[model samples]
Target: MTSITIRNVPDEVHRALRIRAAMHGRSTEAEIRGILEQAAKPEGRLKLGTLLNSIARDAGGLSDAEARRFDKLRDRAPAEPMRFE
Candidate 1:
């Protein structure tokens, strides 16, 4: 394993990291390691259905009627093409 030294991190950011580490019951160094690990890994792509489901869940789950109305709005015809002289 390699070691690194991060130089000149802002005081507020360092403080926040310490607070987060305390919250998660980890040392600040361990918290930094976890942060670096997550940053190094590529995040998985969220599919449209998955993204929509998450949004619906956060918004208290959309009603069936609301979903239908959204679908109708989404399927509406595009606006008329611009006619430039």
Candidate 2:
């Protein structure tokens, strides 16, 4: 097997990765491998109608007008503040 080393990682980022690995019951190396696997998946090239149909099926079948209204509502919702007091 080949081995590699990462250098110059920021302290906070390293700590975050360690925390995530612990949360998922994996070694940091295994956690990194899982992340790389997900990142390497082919970008799905689904058409708009197919994607919408998939989402509607998951949500128990929204009509076309209902889906459009949901999209508008999602677009108009306010984004949360970066930090909450």
Candidate with best TM-score: 1
Task: Itemize residue pairs with steric clashes in candidate 1.
Answer: none
The digit string of per-residue lDDT tens for model 1 on 1-85 reads 8999989999999999999999999999999999988887647856565579568957888876777677676735556989998
* Model 1, global lDDT: 0.83
lDDT of each: 0.83, 0.78
Per-residue lDDT over 5-61 for candidate 2, one digit per residue giving the tens place of the 0 to 100 score: 989999998899999999999998999878876787636756566687668768888
lDDT of 1 at 83: 96
User: Could you tell me the TM-score of candidate 1?
Assistant: 0.50
Output the lDDT of residue 5, model 1.
90
Tell me the TM-score of each prediction against the true structure: 0.50, 0.45
Model 2 quality (TM-score): 0.45
lDDT of 1 at 21: 100
